[model samples]
Target: MKKQITSVSLGQNAKMAAALYVVISLPIVLVLAAILAISGQAGQALVVLVATPVVYAGVAALGTLIGGWLYNVVAARVGGFEFTTAEVKAG
Candidate 1:
């Protein structure tokens, strides 16, 4: 069976996904900063540490919102999206 996605809750979904992305990416950003510092790029590291999370969150949120909107438009024209799911039996 195929399921079609007609619409999405843009604001809510964007915010939630962006928050999760920020949370997951923050640590990776910190590690990158640490690596830069260790490589004698302390100035760059400081900038990255201070700016990455904020920039990343903002961009992620905006991108998600825009993407969702575009998807809705394209889907409407193309009969929406289709996906198939399978059921599994637990042992």
Candidate 2:
């Protein structure tokens, strides 16, 4: 069997994880913001949040925490980004 190598190294994994979290949060926020927009309050906030990148950062933080916890209980089987190492190993 061939051993698959991971490209993330070590320290970079943290950054990669964070980036992954942000990427994951985006669709959720857009959806949430849209829902909020339709409702009124969240929509307005969403507009301001969308205008400023800070809100995205906040959403990412919240999403990471929620996503992390949810992954343990529910979403573990759901597909999402995997670090390069996992793909090589899986292949």
Candidate 3:
């Protein structure tokens, strides 16, 4: 099958990207927090664990929003990317 992504929903993309970013960062943050706490900086660890997600989510959302908007604009001018897909049969 052939497909084209003519446009994207910026709000939806941003939300999904933000959530994915937060989920991806959680484990790294957890490990960093544990290391900081083990190094006798529980306060810093707590701050890192709390603050990192907010920052990551904001950055991810903003970036994705901008990218999606740009894609739509460019796609309008130059047409959207086309690709082919095929379904795999269950063996």
**Candidates 2 and 3 compared by lDDT, better number:** 3
Error of 3 at 19 (Å): 0.5
- Candidate 3 Cα errors over 4 Å, as ranges: 87-91
**lDDT of candidate 3 over 7-80, digit per residue (tens):** 99999999999999999999999999999999999999999999999999999999999999999999999889
| 2 versus 3: better TM-score goes to | 3
Give per-residue lDDT, candidate 3, residue 90: 100
Candidate 1 global TM-score: 0.71
Measured by lDDT, the strongest candidate is 3
lDDT of each: 0.87, 0.54, 0.96
Per-candidate TM-score against the hidden true structure = 0.71, 0.41, 0.90
For residues 62-90, what per-residue lDDT tens digits would candidate 1 score against the true structure?
99899999988988888777899888999
Residue 35 shift from truth in candidate 1, angstroms: 4.4
> Per-residue lDDT for 1-91 in model 2, tens only?
3442222233344345656656766777677677777777864766644543454555555655665555544433554334343335553
